[model samples]
Target: MLKVQEIRELIKLIDHSSIEEFTFEHDGSKIKMKKNTGTSVSVVKTVGQPVEIPSAEVVHKPVVQEVPVEKAATVNAEVIQEKVEIESVTDLHKITSPMVGTFYESPTPDTDAYVKVGSKVSKDSIVCIVEAMKLFNEIEAEVEGEIVEVLVKNGQLVEFGQPLFLVKPE
Candidate 1:
């Protein structure tokens, strides 16, 4: 078992890093963490230049104690019928981000958003923009549909494959 303080420290460290996922296992116990992806961790050198570092992990040794033999542990689970109520939800088309970046709802703050709830889009419709490293990339709808939901707010960092909109296909 991990101490609460140790877990807190790890959370804080990961929160400050660009690691998208982390996992640790020891003595039959495991911990997994996933973060909203965006930038990467960088180190500053004497030249005052930033050098990006690849994601890395740190592992700690596990403590163990011998115990007397006993009956094997048994696991129990109960499965209830999940809300099968919305088969229609699976029919909605998802507009996903092509790359990790800052999401933009319009070309500029002064302009109206390209699409909104109930907005009709075509295969070539410019639905939104994604800015990465000062590059503004116009994203297209790629499918004919009516927008049902906008998943992220303007200027929010979006990860690759993150759903940006839900559209009801025309």
Candidate 2:
């Protein structure tokens, strides 16, 4: 039998460590603990007799998937075309979202937009705000330029690395 404090300490250690499973047996008592999608523990006790529980093994069947040759070729072709187009375009500075969040044009709904197309901006100018996890982060221009385009709408969900604006650097 394990003391309450010992069990609590064991649980804390297991939670902090990456060990996914633990099992112990002593005298006529057995304890098994497993951490999967959730954490669970099982205990079995017997007097003057030994109890044996079969160990559970997880088996993941191998998945066999087939991709059509034509589909793969088409995807590669599209990727090449996109790269060519991007390379052919004139050099313009892109302001990309630093994190996944909702884009806001103004600090407050009632305030004027921070930047609009043709608006001049200096490095360190606040061009927009990205609200992520309930925190509003001020996005700086980082480049001295004139706003060429706004790529995202107010309150629109922006993904990490997604372009938010294009600027023509001065």
Candidate 3:
């Protein structure tokens, strides 16, 4: 029979470690814990066979609740708005990277960059190129603006929908 303290400790260990799944068995009893990287944490416990203590035998199991990403984003936005007024500044707009890739400002290594800081750009202007899965994807500005802040450095491994630059609307 597993003690409550042992189960709590195992839960803590699972939470702290990067390992997504863990299982342990002792004296014909088994416990499994799994972490869902995409959304939440789910813990599953089962006894291999007939167990002496029914209270210690957990079947099916319960999932741990986590904050949704959308709600988290809303909270972050509210916090950011409280700290700074984004609308008052007409010259600051976010330019997010459309895909996960290596950011390149020029077509080739020997050539000059397509745009620089303070560069005026249009909605169709190609700001940078993101090389993803061996293909170079030209990243264009979605909104007409002037480049204000370049968020990511060149040759950085950017994730999908990551912020690449901040543009000030012209």
Candidate 4:
């Protein structure tokens, strides 16, 4: 396996040279790299674990224990950035079922749905009904928001804690 500093130097050398592509192999280890006309270089598939490189639009497993330490740091940074962005946005909240039953969109077959996509709802708004053991239970929104999505279909059987609607809270 190549040292991180060695890999860095090799990458630097590749970037500076006019060579369009290069491949090296030793002691059952291999390194393949290619340069494009654009700023980003393309990484080739390795004989190891799968890696997804969006810039190159290629997927390959990494050579066993060959990926540099920087790869881990880069992945961690991307994940942290994604988490920060998720936290910064107004995330949709889930309205889940309290009991197992069949979901109904309306009180009766002829009536309009109690709530639909884009419908604004209050904490107490009855969004749907759950029928179980001959009992029709009114299920409330429980949160103040606009309904973003209905997760369960009419007459669909739902389990406890199953999300029935996604709400963008006020």
Cα RMSD (Å) per model? 13.9, 14.4, 10.5, 16.5
| lDDT tens digits by residue: candidate 4, 1-170 | 56657878998998875456778776555677777433232344456544444355544545433343335456555655654564466688889999988899999999999999999999999999999999999999889999877877898888899889988899
The 0-to-1 C-alpha lDDT of every candidate, in the order given, reads 0.73, 0.75, 0.73, 0.77
For 1-170, candidate 3 gives per-residue lDDT tens digits of: 67778889989988875456888878866666777544332333442445565466545433334555445556565655643554466557777878877898899999988888889999999999999999999989988988876777777778788888778886
Candidate 2 whole-model C-alpha lDDT, 0 to 1: 0.75
lDDT by residue (tens digit), candidate 2, 1-170: 56657868988888765466787777756556666421122333333443333334332222223343334556565655664565466877899999998899999999999999999999999999999999999999999989887878898888899898888888
Clash pairs, candidate 2, are none
Query: Which rank order by TM-score, best down to worst?
Result: 1, 2, 4, 3
Model 4 regions more than 4 Å off: 1-90
TM-score per prediction, in order, is 0.52, 0.49, 0.48, 0.48
TM-score of 1: 0.52
Q: Which window of 10 residues has the lowest lDDT sum in candidate 3?
A: 38-47
Instruction: Tell me, by lDDT, which candidate is best.
Output: 4
Tens digits of lDDT, candidate 1, 1-170: 56657878998888866566788776656566657332222222233223232333334433333222222222111111121222247888999999999999999999999999999999999999999889999999999999988889888889999999988898
Order the candidates by lDDT, highest first.
4, 2, 3, 1
How many pairs of residues collide in model 1? 0
Q: How many Å off is the CA of 123 in candidate 2?
A: 1.0
